[model samples]
Target: MNRHLDTFADSIIAGKRLSEGEAAELSATSGTDAFALFLAASRIKEHFLGTGIDLCSIINAKSGRCPENCAFCAQSAHHATDSPVYPLVDEERIVACAKEAEAAGSHCYGIVTSGTTIRKGEELDRICRAVRRIRETTSIAPSCSLGIIDQETAVTLREAGVETYHHNLETARSFFPSICTTHDYEDDVETVRVAKRAGLTVCCGGIFGLGETAAQRIELAMTLRDLDVDSIPLNFLNPIEGTRLARADLITPLECLKTIALFRLILPEKKIAVCGGRERNLRDLQSWIFFAGASGTMIGNYLTTTGRPAEDDWQMLKDLELTAGSCRE
Candidate 1:
């Protein structure tokens, strides 16, 4: 293990945040030094967040026909992918999905849609109704990933029973232009800011393995740290068949674990939920996410993708002796 890695980890453990330079150094580490980094991150996670895992699930409330030309997205209209395309489901169906997530022991249920922006209209009304239904009937907290949002819409979602508003940066500012062109990177940042200002806990994170360098990953984390987001969902790229990133190779499991540890080191106390692409990317090393210092993870289906079964995930938690939920079930 490198001396600087230990020193930086010790600094984080002793209540000091990692500087951009130190974070870059950590991202540059590989092999055993990186494994040591994971250990140190696990310690920081246990010290700050305890061993309880915050489990969340999401339903693609609406699908496909998106105008955004994001290279990694299968739902974009510019792509020739076979991703499911449909209008937003009615409130009853949304409620049913929320209830299912709750029953599977998920602490949060997010309603995600495929679009550039989830504006105010009938779609908004239906989402509000679904949120209300979930709040009235289930213990699971309601959340949304309704694209770029204004402060007014953020407040409206809050009043509609949304506890968190998820708007992923998707990648670092420097790398974003290569990945998506329809929306500006600053728009994502502003959405998170507005969501936070409107009294919603911001769940902001980015996808990895989109041809970004390790330093770029750290850059995204720094941006998230600055945003003071409440939850961070670390999604690995899944390379849908028709997207521009379809031929992009998958990141190694070890690298993914290291990335999760880096996220823990960067945002020591924030909820780090390992979401989309875990199944293929993590493979046999999936449970290593907990060991690498993730505070939570998504369990069940994903937007345009299937995830590991809830039962398998539950058993993995049991095998690892880690409690599930935002705290405990």
Candidate 2:
């Protein structure tokens, strides 16, 4: 183990944060040094956040016909991907999905819609109703990822019992145009701000490996820290066939672990729930996420792809002796 890496880790454990240059150097670690880097992150997580793991599930409540042109998304009508396209499901269906998630030991159930935003209409009403019933019928927390929300919508969702709001910044401000252009970076920032003003916990994080540089990942983490988000869902990009990023190279499993560790070191006590692209991106090394300092992960189907069976995840957790984390507690 590199003594310098150990020293840096100690500093973080002592509440010392990395400067931008220090963050850049850590992001560049690999081989044996990388091992030490990840070890430090795991230790920090165990020390500061405890060994608790937060597991959540998301249903693609609404699919496709997205107006934005994010290069990494198959749901955009701008792309010709063979993804399912549909309006928001009925309240009954949404409630059923939430119950299924709760039954599977998920602490939170998220309703993610594929659009620039869900305008105030029948879709929004159904989503609000679904959020209410999930709370009334089950012991699970309800969250929503209905893009670019205004203060009024955030208040409405909060009134309907939505505890958390999900909106990703997707990439660093400097690199934003490369991944998406239809929406402004500030548009996302504003929504997170609005949701927070309405007393909603913001669950925000961006996708990795969309051709962003290592420094850019650090930049994204710093932004999330500044936002004081309640939870951060780190998603590795899954290059969908029809999306512009299909030609983008796959992020290696080692790099994925490194990024998770990086997020943990940067955010410290904040909830780090590793979400989409774990199966494809991490492959055989999926269990390393906990060691990399992730406090939780998403289970069941992703927005555009199938996830490993929930039983598989449960068995993995049992083998690792990691417990499922709950927002309620």
Number of the top TM-score candidate: 2
lDDT of 1 at 239: 89
Clashing pairs in 2: 53-325
Candidate 1: stretches off by over 4 Å:
2-4, 327-329
The 0-to-1 C-alpha lDDT of every candidate, in the order given, reads: 0.90, 0.91
Candidate 1 lDDT over residue span 59-163, tens digit each: 998999999999999899999989999999988899999989988999999999989888578999999988998999988889999899888888899998999
Model 2 score (lDDT): 0.91
TM-score of every candidate: 0.97, 0.98
Cα misplacement distance, residue 242 of candidate 2 (Å): 1.0
Pick the lDDT winner: 2
Error at 173, model 1, angstroms: 0.3
Candidate 1 residue 143 C-alpha distance from true site, Å: 0.2
